[model samples]
Target: MKARTDTKEKIMELGTDLVESIGYPSLSYQQISSQLGIKNAAVHYHFPSKESLGLEILNTAIGSFEKMISNISSLGLWEQLDTFFKSYRKHLESNNKICLIGASASDYQELPESMQAAASEYLVLVKGWFVELLREGREEGVFHFKGEPKHKAAVIVSALAGGLQHARLVGNLHYDEIVEQLVEDLKP
Candidate 1:
């Protein structure tokens, strides 16, 4: 039983590495098996199908982000918001400045319904954090927004994702600058 579990884990790990390195659509099972030094049938035995493997990769990626963000601590609500954004920025910098969840979420519609549902859950949870922070900040007089908190949260997430894409495409240092500016904009 333990050996079976380990094999499943190993396959999932390889799948995640392939997705993060080459992207989900381009990740070939045969290539992953070659990298794993195993027969493609071994991978197929564990995953049954490519969609299953993709779903596992999606789960692992989202789980990793949740674990990373759950570690931040702050004394006050505003400080919590600051810590959240700052920690996220640091995560981006530390992870080669890549948006893992956002990248995976982009391919959700193309994946199976199970994967899309998982992706939607992760995205809604992330958006909820921003919404909570924005609402709390406004309540405490630490933030002023012209729109609803949930809408503001959506804007923040979209802008951040858009800025990252622009930075990648334009080869500019303005990405971090834009994120920092948004942090300030979230202030009262």
Candidate 2:
């Protein structure tokens, strides 16, 4: 796997920043070009279309979380789970908006297959991580489950994501509180 050139990485990094700040629906290549102090052609040279750029940006953001998830130690899975949820809550606090998954899923069906695939892959990864963690906890007798851990892990991931969306919808939901409550419930 060849590393991306600095300029190409810069372009993608800028694209992610712009999308997070302005939003994907309102993002413009012209604005990105202007922000980079380059001609629109430069932006197009790196990304042929806005959708392609959006996908790259989304992938980059997801890659960050993947790195963090991969870094989690199996020796401390419950602690790792708490850290993951805490990090997620911090993201919500900082962004003060729905996450990429939440926002993208809202209109996911209308998006290109690549974008939809990206969103689907994220949820799959989250569920996969939860399954691993939950299984570890159950093996240690620190977690009790009425059903299969894998199935419950999927349900928990979906519920946590749904909770975030609900918090965003209700306007007064506290993300930290929700996350803390989730952590408590997950504890043995």
Candidate 3:
């Protein structure tokens, strides 16, 4: 929309990175502008408010995660689980950033009403995917867990989220242990 023609995209890219790397509440137009070497008005021009930016990030994250889950839908059960675990691990390489789900969730109370709704939608989509995956995997004898799929899925998701946060304070070993034990515990 400007001479750069990708300023809006760049803003969104940096915006989300900041949200995941730092917390969403820590994100600021000034911080974004400083990182992108643009003026604060440049960010403001595209996103009139922080809520607008947060909403856009959540929407984009939902679409991205939907696509990711679908892409791995054809894989073997264990492979699919490995891919899912890898997604969370990828963030550990980048300033101890957690997944967007965890980042947005930590700020849920501070989010605007619309942002909160989007966050809830994101949660449902992810947890639903995990629940279905666990159900199918167990039915196929790929997993040997002893709880309702929904309950187990919630525990897995929450542990991974918390593991990422804990990784930042301690080290990645704690995160790796969580992933390993999760898979081990689900073994046949």
**Can you list the residue pairs that collide in candidate 3?**
none
Q: Which candidate model has the greater TM-score, 2 or 3?
A: 3
Angstrom error at residue 100, model 2: 2.3
Model 3 C-alpha lDDT versus the unseen true structure: 0.90
Decide which is better by lDDT, 2 or 3: 3
Compose the digit string of candidate 1's lDDT tens values, residues 1-188.
Answer: 88778778888876766665456777788887887788888888888888888877767766776775566434576667666556545534543343545666666556678877776777787788789878878988988877899999998877766665566566436567777777677666
C-alpha TM-score for every candidate: 0.77, 0.78, 0.95
Looking at candidate 1, the ten consecutive residues that score lowest on lDDT are 91-100
Residue range 108-176, candidate 2, lDDT tens digits:
766688988987887777778788778878888776666787898776666666666666656425555
| Alpha-carbon runs more than 4 Å astray in model 3 | 1-5
Q: How accurate is candidate 2 locally (lDDT)?
A: 0.71
- Residue 41, candidate 3: alpha-carbon lDDT: 93
Clashing pairs in 1: 142-188
Best by lDDT: 3
RMSD of each: 3.2, 3.5, 1.4
C-alpha lDDT (0 to 100) for residue 33 of candidate 3:
91
lDDT of 3 by residue, 1-188 (tens): 36554988999999988999877888999998998899999899889999999999999989999899889989999999999899879889888988888887888888889988998898889899989999999999999898799999999999999999999999999999999999998999
